[model samples]
Target: GAGVSQSPSNKVTEKGKDVELRCDPISGHTALYWYRQRLGQGLEFLIYFQGNSAPDKSGLPSDRFSAERTGESVSTLTIQRTQQEDSAVYLCASSPHGSLTDTQYFGPGTRLTVL
Candidate 1:
């Protein structure tokens, strides 16, 4: 796909397990962000990164949740010891640059289910 894309639109995992989801942003976009939406809830920020700098992890629910960005390219979000409460849609978005929120484009999202 030419736009941002995500793998395994749905995932099911047992509690205490770890899961890794992938994202591919638009070509040449340098800014990437991760967010999650609990069932019937608003989007909660998780992490955002500009190029190779350490991402802003303030929005991460816990140390169990972490992400990394490589250059201005791909990213991965890993959830360790996943819990039922962690079940949600993991969305990846990208913009042209990191100076500001410049119309972030989102993928279909990966639905992580912690049973």
Candidate 2:
């Protein structure tokens, strides 16, 4: 495939609401990662999934944040009881081997706004 793709490019919701962000990685890529970027801040690793191995959930901020990837395809990030501070750009990236040394392709990101 050309590159990673994300859905619902932008979202607006009240505080305490839940939001689901979707990402489609490039075909054949085996590594998928989710990150969050708050305004004026850097990207924070959220979650990572590679192959059939168990996902690395250490990066998740809290129990409210979770993600799931099916094989090497699409992945979803779900935020429960969203807070205003959760407003930011959620980014997804994919690599061929899910290795730190591999080059990763990034998606456009989903801008989330919690009013």
lDDT of 2 by residue, 22-80 (tens): 99999999999999999999999989999999999998988999898887899999999
| C-alpha RMSD in Å of predicted model 2 compared with the true structure | 0.9
List TM-scores for all candidates, in order: 0.94, 0.96
Q: Considering only N, C-alpha and C atoms within 3 Å, which residue pairs clash in candidate 2?
A: none
Cα-lDDT of candidate 1: 0.90
lDDT of 2 at 33: 92
lDDT of each: 0.90, 0.93
RMSD of each: 1.2, 0.9
Residue 21's lDDT in candidate 2: 98
Q: Taking the tens digit of each residue's C-alpha lDDT, what string does model 1 give over 1-115?
A: 4999998799999999999999999988888989999989999999998877777889999999888777788899999999999999999998888765489999999999999
